[model samples]
Target: MMHHLGKVALPVYFWLFVTWLFLPLFVMAAMGFRDSNFVAFPIQSWTTDWYQSVLDDREILASLWVSLQVAVLSTILGLGIGTPMAFMVARFHGVWRAILITIIVMPAFIPIVVSAIALRMFIGNFGIQTGLVAIAFGHAVSSVPFVVVMLLTRLNSMSPNLADAARDLGADEFIIFFRVVLPYLSPALFGAFMFCMLLSFEDFTRSFFLGSFDPTFPVLLFARLRFGFDPGLAAISTLVLVATIALGIYAERFTRKRTAPAKQGRLAASGDDKNV
Candidate 1:
């Protein structure tokens, strides 16, 4: 009775939610194949020329390249800053840990538009003109909190005995970090790397505020939308959306694969420490 209804309702709700989320994306992808120059209703014909035209559009290509460079730069900066912050936070306990985490992740709670404006002001005061470097820095600022949280989750699960074992082997802090801590953190680090890149690439407000002459893909897309929509725009968007999804899937699989060996190595090291 109720159980049967619950079971039926659950699957129905799940599929409904999935459709609500992904149906638009599917529609956008379909729009790319439309043969007409304009984006509109039922496809009378289909062609790949829109996708090809995206390749020929130098402005689109240049903006995409800018987005890629910003992604890479911001991810590097986020990882570097977040790794040390995670380590520092891990050393604290109880209320102190809570306080530290609150301060570090506060940026994530701030409104994006406000944060972007504040960052722009901060950089301008230092005489840093808005451009590629400024955009990368702004992205990094937003990404750091997420990186810290991700790394901290992995860091908390780590066995302190592994570090102790390395120290017992006459390894210094630097050596232990490189040989033990870093290898253990590799999966989380890799996941963070991909996450920051994706975050920076898709971000609009921060990139928009931080950029000057050069625009990122999202900013450029927004600018073009004022003129009107076209099949070519849809084609480029569909391609980027698909690539992002594929990269996300790859990151998940790569993290899972790396997690197993990292755990095994940590256990083996712990055993060796006991024997010694």
Candidate 2:
């Protein structure tokens, strides 16, 4: 009886955990269709008025556009900075290698509030009063570590002989990178890009600290939430969630297309080498 109770308890706990994790999102999504101005249970008559209100608000529209711009720019900057760092860390080992990795990963380990405040001060002290510039800069710095960590893991898993083989065949660095490394790293790159972009879009702390009057969508939504719970905000959230899910699926498919052939060939070659 005790043993059966334990088994039943585990499944119950697992279902409870899953429910707890998604219950808020489910409630929030429900509020988007709920007909009340306030987010409440027993969600009153269903309507599309909340979504229309989101579209009608100029501030919401502007903030959402800014969020997209910032996310795109920050992710692009992270890609440029993270690729070289990942390549170097994965390829080289020295006294400085660990230090480099620690530095890159420290942002992720540190409290995001602390990072936001620190970035706000640093950028402010430079006399940079611009909103988007500060926001994008903060996002790029904070997100670079995520890109480096993911890309480095992918790079480390790759065949070391590939670069050497390319060099032996008289392929230049650019050719080898475009032909071999990029194909292998496509999935990691896609994941990193999407992660950074989504983070930038959803980040409230840094956006709150970095922007003066022009806050990103999350920051703006939070500010509004302080007044009262708005069903329109729920509508915005549901839209963002749906869009992000769609984008993630598209990116996964794109990554698979780029990685499939290379992955099969590499596995075949690796098996042949082991057999030899």
Candidate 3:
């Protein structure tokens, strides 16, 4: 009875959670079509002029380009550094592993605002002035920890015998990782990449602190918000939300393609450990 009750309760809870989370966004998106300069409720009529203006704004375009550069640079850097770190943690076992785990998970607990301030000050002391490089580096530093932790979790859940079998078959570490292990991990890696990219793109504190001359989209948006509401910003928000959802759908499809093998491995592991 409890299990059945839980099954129904969870869906209801999730639906409510989603509704609450998205209601504001729906309202914001609706304001884009509001036939007025300011964003307000009871949106009357409909128009796409706000979206049209967003495309024409040179400042918005420039900031969007900068944001794209920073997000791409940060995701690349995070992926390069994080993949190895995750593998090391997942496969190795020692006292140092515990210490490394602590280090990787610590940054997630720290606020982005706090990290932004500390990183800016640290870079400044080293004569590294704020700019695209600084902003990208900061984003990578913040996101790498998330990639490491999440990837490590996924890797740990994977079957260990697959790696052992690959070794026994005379497969080198590189070949085994690329050919055998990577398929299982591609989903997690892509998810982490998306997380890092979105965070870097939406980041305001780090960009405000470190992006000296080339302000990012979020920074520019905040500046514009200081003056008053523009329905164009709502249009931009709607577009961003749509892009995010589209990326999520693509990732889900990409991951589903390779999930069968992971499931089979889980079944094999379950059979092998039947006594447990």
Candidate 4:
């Protein structure tokens, strides 16, 4: 009786928690469509004017362009640095490897605000005015740790025998890595890229500190929100939410497609050996 009750309670609690988390998002989305200049709960009438207004806002567009440049550059740079570090950490076993991984991931555990402040002070001393380059550098620093951790986890779970098999087949080190390890790491790489992109997009504290001459999207959004409530802000937020959801779905599909063949190949190999 107790076991059955516990099983029933688990799903009920899960649904409740899910609802709790998404309720506010739903509310905000609805408010975005409200036919009013100011954001108000329990929207009076539905209209798309706010979204149109946001689309026409020049400052918002410029901020979005700045954000896109930063996010893309930062994610690319993080992947370049993080992928090799992840491979090393996953493939090698040594005291130095562990120490290196620890050092690489240490920045992630630090408070974002603290890291931002430190970056601000450092950049200030160099007389580097805050702008696109500063934002990209700050975002890359913050996101690399996440990419390394995610890729390392994926690499560790992969079978080392793949590399060994390639070597046994007379493949050189570079060829074996490119043919074997690269395919295996594809899903994790895509996931890390998406994560880094999102981190760069939604970052507020780091952008606030590192941004001076031009602001990123989030920084601009914050500045707009400080003056007064705008329904257009809600519209922008909703658009961002929808974009994030779409990207998440796309990433899932990409990962599944990349990994499915590897899993099926393993199964087929086991079946062949059994038949033999």
Candidate 5:
């Protein structure tokens, strides 16, 4: 009886949750079509002129370029550093492992504003000025913890026997890692990459403190909002939402492809053994 009640209630709860989550987004999307100059609750009529204006704005374009550079660079650096660290933590058993993992994850707990301020002070002392490089470094620091956690979860789910079998077959360490481990990890890596990209793109506090001349997307958006809310901002947000959803779908497909074949192969082999 309880199970049936839960099943019936689940759909209603899910719809409520979805509506709660997407209400603001829907409002923003609606505002994107407003024909008026000022931002208003009830949009009069549909118009795409604001989107066109945003497209023609040189500052927005430049800010987007800067944001793209920072997000890409930060994701690359985070992946390069975090993946190995995750593997070590997942596979190794030692006292130092926990300590090291905790240290790697500490950055996530640190407030972004505090981290940004510390970086600014540290870099200033070394005569390193704020710009794209500073922003990239700050983003990398913040993003690496997430990458580590995601990759660690993936690594933990993998069977230890697979790695041992690879070693017994005389595969070298590099080849075993690349062939046996990386394929299973691709989905997680893609997820981490997308998360890092979104975080870097949407960051504002760090950018405000560390961004000197080159501002990121969020920083630019904040500046635009200060002047007054524009319909173009809504359009840009809608684009971001669509892109994120598309990336999530692609990652899900990739994960299914990677795991499905192995399961099928096992089932086929089991059936063959039974026939014998």
Candidate 6:
């Protein structure tokens, strides 16, 4: 009896949680279709004019362009920095490894507002003005910790024998890294690439503190919200949200597709070894 109740309760709980997570998104999507200027409940009519109008909003378009630039710059910087950090971390062990991890991931624990302010001050000390470069740097700083963690996780699961096998073939360290280690890390790198871009794109505090005349998408949205908003804002947000979701789905599938071939090769190699 208890088992049956537990089974029923689990499905109910899952559905409830899913609804809680996605209901707001559905409502927001619906809000975009609202015919009225002001956002409200019980839409008396529906229209797509708001969505059409957003395409003509120069300010919004500019902000989106700024956001795309920041995302690309931050992802590159994050991967460039974090990939080496992950390799370095993988070389350490015991207390030293723990200490290194703590220091590297310290930024993730810091409050965003505090970190943003600190970054702002730090950059100002070097006479770096708040703008695209500054915002991208800030985003990179935040993304590095997560990048290190993700890459390290993938690195840890890798068998050292692969590197050893390459070394036995007389490959130099750099050749082994590029040919063996890098290809092995492709899935993790791709995932990190997407993650860093998303982190930078969605970031508000860092962009706000680091921005100058040009603002990121989130910062611009916040500014617009202060005056008032129309269905057009919701329309734009829904479109962005849809795009983000689609990108995430694509990344996930791409990563899986990449890793599958590697996994199958590893399994086949293992089976041959066992047979021998």
Misplaced by over 4 Å in model 2 are 1-7, 249-264, 271-276
Backbone clash count for every predicted candidate, in the order shown? 0, 0, 0, 0, 0, 0
In terms of lDDT, the best-performing candidate is 6
List all candidate RMSDs to the true structure: 3.1, 3.0, 3.3, 3.5, 4.3, 2.7
Model 3: lDDT to the true structure: 0.85
| TM-score versus the correct structure, for each prediction | 0.94, 0.87, 0.85, 0.87, 0.84, 0.93
For model 3, residues 105-143, the per-residue Cα lDDT tens digits are: 787788878988899999988899999989999999889
Best by TM-score: 1
User: Candidate 6, which segments miss by more than 4 Å at Cα?
Assistant: 267-276
Point out the worst 10-residue segment of candidate 2 by lDDT.
267-276
For residues 1-276, write the lDDT of model 5, one tens digit per residue. Answer: 889878988888999999999899889888888898778877768998876777787888899899999989988898898888797788666878788888988988988789999998888888889999888889888999899998887676566667787899999999998998897688788878887887887789888898987788789888878887778888777776777678767876886676667555434533443322
Tens-digit lDDT string for candidate 4 (1-276): 889778998889999999999998888888889997777667778999998889998998899888999999889888998888787777567988788878988888889899988888888888887877788889989888888888887676566577788899999999987888877788889988998898898888888988876888889888888898777888888898899889978987987787678666655534433322
For candidate 5, the per-residue lDDT at 32 reads 80
- Candidate 3, residue 170: the lDDT equals 99
Q: CA lDDT of each candidate?
A: 0.92, 0.85, 0.85, 0.84, 0.81, 0.93
Error of 2 at 243 (Å): 2.0
Candidate 5 runs further than 4 Å off? 1-13, 256-276
| Local error of candidate 6 at residue 207 (angstroms) | 0.7
Compared with the true structure, what per-residue lDDT tens digits does model 1 show for residues 151-243?
998887787898897899999999999999888898999999999999999999999988998999999999999999999999999999999
**Candidate 3 deviant stretches above 4 angstroms:** 1-17, 269-276
